[model samples]
Target: MKPLSPDVFDAAQALWLQIRMFAKGMLLPWRLNQLLAIAALFLIAHFAAKPIGHWLTTWLRKRQGWTKWKLRLGILIQQRVRVILFALLAWILVAVMRELTWPSRSQLIALAASIATAWAAIGFVTRIIRTRLLRRLVRWFAWIFATLYFLDFLTVAENLLDSLALSFGEFRLSALTVIKAVVVTVVMIVAARLFSRFVTRKLAKNSDIAPEVQILISKVLQGVLITLAILIGVKAAGFDLTGFTVFTGALGVGLGFGLQKVISNLMSGFIILMDKSIKPGDVISIGDTFGWIEELGARYTSVVTRDGREYLVPNEDLVTGQVVNWSHTNDFVRLDLFFGASYRDDPHEVTKIAINASLSVKRVLAQRTPVCWITGFGERSVEYILRFWISDPTAGITNVKGQVYMAIWDAFKKNGVELPYPQMEVRMLRANRDEENAPHFQMTTSLKD
Candidate 1:
């Protein structure tokens, strides 16, 4: 090779001198200047970056007319930005180390490692920022990012790894293969998130469904997006989906045995959703278990009862059992109060009083119009049936009944319509002498058998 330029030689010599100085400082038993210098640099960067990030974030929020949540969100973003900036500065210091250590392959390798580590750090911070954007947006971001970084770090470390492999007369692998896999995986995840957000936003814009339903649908869409993303990531990881047909048999066997209940419930849940028979917020009664439908999972439905207990009913039960949807077509529910009045009271008058009593209740729906009828004639009383409807079922049936019955009690007392008790008439025979004497009178009329 031609002799290097004078400038290059001088630069090389300077780098060599810095490396020698650094090594000597490390070897010195009591030298503290190098350590203090490094610590001072880190502290300066940390304090300076944090305050600057905070001021910048505050200014941004003021300009954007941020809400309390948004301001808090911005503060979190600023913190993350500060950390990332500090990390980048640290990496730049390592690159400076490589420059001062002369042009050696190991120095270049260390520089590359530092760059890879810094890149992973940036990605981790970005994921955290994204997760914190919405309220409690799931804290799984750190785990996922860590896994991704490990995979990427493994890929980037392949060069030194393959050299070791070559020393053992083994096969060599390129770092590019591993790096490409990580890049493609990251791209897939980002794409999935974007697509999911777009679909969820679109679904939320539809006003027909309840808010909970919209949120549930959005979650389902996100799950589907993630599944698709996984498939794409697998493809990017150098796996050919078409070549993996042999795994189908294994998958089928797993589904047949291990995942039977999961598959069954999932299918049943889909059916329930499509039929629109059971939905979020519906007040459904399944056997003795009655509650508002809080969530519909793949295998079970969560019902939040009035007592604040949540019941998880299997999806199959919801489809197979008798479900009383109190608010099926409408929120109107009718309650019947059966009362029996004294036989001396006129049947027509009893019916009129019952009707008026139902009308007096505030919860009674005027549009439905309360109805009363003389349902039956008993030995001691005439039975009256009062049927009335109310609009809100989630407020409960008992409360409505209480109001109507209270009104009825008041009306009956005012109208002098006494609610009769159960009564019976009985005849008793006297002793044998009296029975024989009574029978003697009838003996002439009829002969005993």
Candidate 2:
């Protein structure tokens, strides 16, 4: 084997000396007592934690008028009671031992207390992070770092990480830098998203703002905040932002070609939102699809139809194709009903009956006043058209039309108006009864009621 490098040799020698010193220290009576005392304190804390945790949970439950924040804090503290108690007790023992005996005798207890303290504090603080995997990883990372610092091995770790590096003309990147970059990036992005969401929710509650405007504001704010966060995080982690211009340009070019439709839809979505032509809860008809607008997404708009099926219509279609917004200005919709009555019936009496029948329907707008007029005279009867208004179009138009038809039928039946129908008459000429099977026949029609 080649001779060890100078740095490697030095590190090995330092580690050997530390091991020897640790072995020597353990042989002393005071060090052994110190170790035993820490072990006993940890044991006592573990056994006492169960009862303390139970009691704390009960106490919090019994308390009245406590804020949710305070209750949550108490629960978090209760979960780490063992570590917290051990840290406190160990420190007190360490202080007393130092006062009564040599300070060196309590150093082991101090180290234990220091580690326990870091564990309890970091664990409690990390509990508030919502993502489960991220929270666990952060806790582990913090614990390891704190442990290294307490053991005076943090500098060693830094040197190790720094040794594994790539150097450019003026910039150097090491493992430590990369780790810090990841941590900072995650922190900044999460914080930005949370803040953006909170502001969006507050904006949503304002009745003065239109729905599309609210969405536009939310999208613009989220994009800006995330962009700023990324830049700030990269700079804060000691990376030069100027170095990414060429890469960003190349990425932009690639995205433009690869995501043409996606970008178009996104842009179209923004246009739709800005124009305020369509909004949530608006009943829109595109192509053959008709429904209430559920949500506006970057790529598509969610439309839920009367049949309970949801259609994801592309934003491009909404922008390019013809869209009919039924309730755009107001909820009022006018529907037409056509029917004919016998020629013998008076037109004035028929119009009056039709109007009264339309008014009797529940969905027909009584305030708007339904109207009936003689559209034209049919071949055998008088044709009439009834026009009526409805306030709610989303409840459906077909059912309400059927209701009006039924009302009109009932009203006409209750009165003396006769509905016209065609009557068929057949006259067959047979040479004799023998020709009845293959008879020459004449067909005639009559329009009568």
Candidate 3:
């Protein structure tokens, strides 16, 4: 072989030295003992995790009386404990490995912090997996991981975050930004969860409010929370307050024009709530439409008609127009059924039969006795009115009326009362003939006839 050049020989010697250093780095003089210690720590942590999980699960179950759902609670506690113990084991192992690399307390502490952060990262991932469907929980974990990753200054990820957070003037932050972010994140999460819980409970308990109204409240709560979260995030990012000043006038103007109807409806809804006039389950009549109030939305009301068609009426109309609430004070309604009989039938007997028929209907209120009135006399018949009371007006007055009419038909047939139809009379006179003309039936025949 030809002799190598001097530069190539020097390069080959440097490469050989680097490889030896790498092999030395991998093989620690204390590797066997350190590995044994790590394995022992892991076993200890694993055994400790079980009792810790049991204690936590038992405490939660007994405190909340969750004996029926104990399995679910136990799983939650187990997961948390497993993550914590595993994180501890990982840190101890990392510290042992780092000491084997370079024995120093600072190195060990740094290694432990790095290992703990990695464990937190893994825990974050598992939490996301467990709460895949829960968007809020996922977002919370994401924020927590982001915070931890930022605090991980000893790790390579911390430099990356610092660089990213410094990329733009808007993203740039002082030391104060981290503190603000932490405080705001904590406050926002707690507030949003608490607010949602409170509103849900309130909505479930309130009976007088319509479903639509409760839904509206829920939507408002969600919007408020999201807005607060955004504001907090913005402030935490160290943006100036002056940036939002322009939105104030624009928001006002938008509300004045774009949201005028919405505001009107909202006010009308509040009025409806306070007045206690039109509530869920109340039968109401407005114009030609009549139905039971199904829901009350912020901008409109849902009325379920007797025909089962839902009508969305604007809230402004409810406040302005006359609405007949059948169940306002009580669900009682009095309706009249008019019938006429031939003059030949005894009026007293006809009235008694009609009154008895009204009382015989199942829905008719017996306490409010049915009244029979000799309303008027027509040329062909004597008209009678049967006025009856019913307590279930929400079922519509027609059903009760039909029942009463059917009963009356039966009673009249049994009693031999003659219900009369209209009759008319006609008279004719022959016209007298004058000299010029005469009205007559003419026949083309012989003149002798």
Local distance difference test values of all predictions, in order = 0.67, 0.88, 0.69
Candidate 1 lDDT trough over 10 residues, lowest sum:
440-449
lDDT of 1 by residue, 158-259 (tens): 333233321113423333444455556655666777887887688778888775566567657767877777777767766556755768778889778998
Residue 402 lDDT (model 3): 89
Preferred candidate (TM-score higher): 1 or 3: 1
Would you give me the overall lDDT of model 1? Answer: 0.67
In order of listing, the candidates' clash counts read 0, 0, 0
Pick by TM-score: which candidate is best?
2
TM-scores vs. true structure, each candidate: 0.61, 0.67, 0.51
- Please give the lDDT score at residue 332 for candidate 2: 93
Tell me how candidate 2 scores on lDDT: 0.88
Q: Rank the candidates by lDDT, best first.
A: 2, 3, 1
Count residue pairs with overlapping backbones in model 1: 0
Q: Is candidate 1 or candidate 2 better by lDDT?
A: 2
Candidate 3 off by > 4 Å: 1-194, 202-234, 237-242, 306-309, 376-381, 422-449
